[model samples]
Target chain A: SAVISQKPSRDICQRGTSLTIQCQVDSQVTMMFWYRQQPGQSLTLIATANQGSEATYESGFVIDKFPISRPNLTFSTLTVSNMSPEDSSIYLCSVVSFGEAFFGQGTRLTVV
Target chain B: AQTVTQSQPEMSVQEAETVTLSCTYDTSESDYYLFWYKQPPSRQMILVIRQEAYKQQNATENRFSVNFQKAAKSFSLKISDSQLGDAAMYFCAYGGSGSARQLTFGSGTQLTVLP
Candidate 1:
């Protein structure tokens, strides 16, 4: 299984501030996914990012609000822009290979 | 489009007992993959088991096993001799074969294992 290192692990930011979460995989993967798991809620797909191209955001999610960057096969970043209290959630980065998927430990964000 | 459904929002089972979590999904693809992921209080996403739509035999790993019915589009997870560590939120996910193989997850079922 591939090991994913995600940071800052957690953060507390004031409303209207923005935060960027980074995910680093131990190995190279073509595509990486970003997901948001709200407090006591299920995981929602934010976007699918591919190396060297634009990311595809899911319905109800926008590139302006949740921008994703995949600079290379092993690194990707998701930025939550203009954060609000509602933006508080655990952000996860994941990759799938050979019918199995691996996820990062997740970044827990709290906006007040 | 694919949608995974987990009818039970929460469930409880006595330690060392057996419990099954139900899951059903809707998809048009003939070949795909179904997965059961466990998220504990630590919030790490752990893959419990996986079943291929093309395979008729169920998939199992230790005490965790899946009952997969391809025609009914049903996949269920059964944990035998459950332990306290089994308590967590369980999510059922679906992924179709493609370049953009993103997983569609269920709402999730919170399992409580009582000691």
Candidate 2:
């Protein structure tokens, strides 16, 4: 198991503003992923952040809306751009290694 | 495409009693992994238990145990001596070995532990 942490646990941002959530892991990992959990809904995968390359977004998501950066193995960031009221949800980062994936203390973003 | 399902939207149980959360998944592959995660009001997702499809014996951890019915594609979690802390949203997840290690989570079941 890996200890994962996210910065700015909760934030209130105005519509049209962008917020970048940071995820830090205790050790190097091969794959990092981003997920969104809307109020009273199940989680949906946003993208897979791979170090040194662009992320692979899920079917309903796009890179322009959720830009991701995985500069290294132990850290990654997901920025929700041009936020809107519909974008209000908890953003989580996950890491997978040795067939096990762990989640961070999600970032609760409230867009007003 | 793989999908996980938690049919029960919410469940309630009295403290010190036992409760079971049901989960079923659809998959074409033979080998995979199943997991149950607990999310409290604090909203932190915590791993409760896991089971590997290839393993015939069920997996158990403390008060948490799983009934893995491979042929039925069912993975249910049983909490013994349920505590108030067990009140939360529980999510069922599925992941396969190899490069396809991404987890597919089910709609959560909110468990309410009453005193």
Against the hidden true structure, what lDDT does model 2 obtain? 0.92
Native-referenced TM-scores of chain A, all candidate models: 0.98, 0.97
Question: Least lDDT summed over 10 consecutive residues: which range in candidate 1 chain B?
Answer: B95-104
lDDT (C-alpha) at residue B20 in model 2: 95
Instruction: Write model 1 residue lDDT over A1-112, tens digit each, in one string.
Output: 7899999999999999899999999999999999999998889999999999999999999999999999999999999999999999999999998767889999999999
Kindly list the per-residue Cα lDDT of model 1 for residues B44-90, writing each as its tens digit.
Answer: 99999998888899999999999998889999999999999999999
Residue B34's C-alpha lDDT in candidate 2? 93
| Interface RMSD, candidates in the order listed | 1.4, 1.5
Give the runs in model 1 whose Cα sits over 4 Å from its true position. B98-100
lDDT score for candidate 1 against the true structure: 0.94
Report the TM-score of chain B alone for all candidates: 0.97, 0.97
- The reply for model 2, stretches above 4 Å from the true place, is none
Give lDDT tens digits, candidate 2, residues B1-115: 8999999999999999999999999999998889999999898888899898899999999999999999999999999999999999999999987773679999999999999
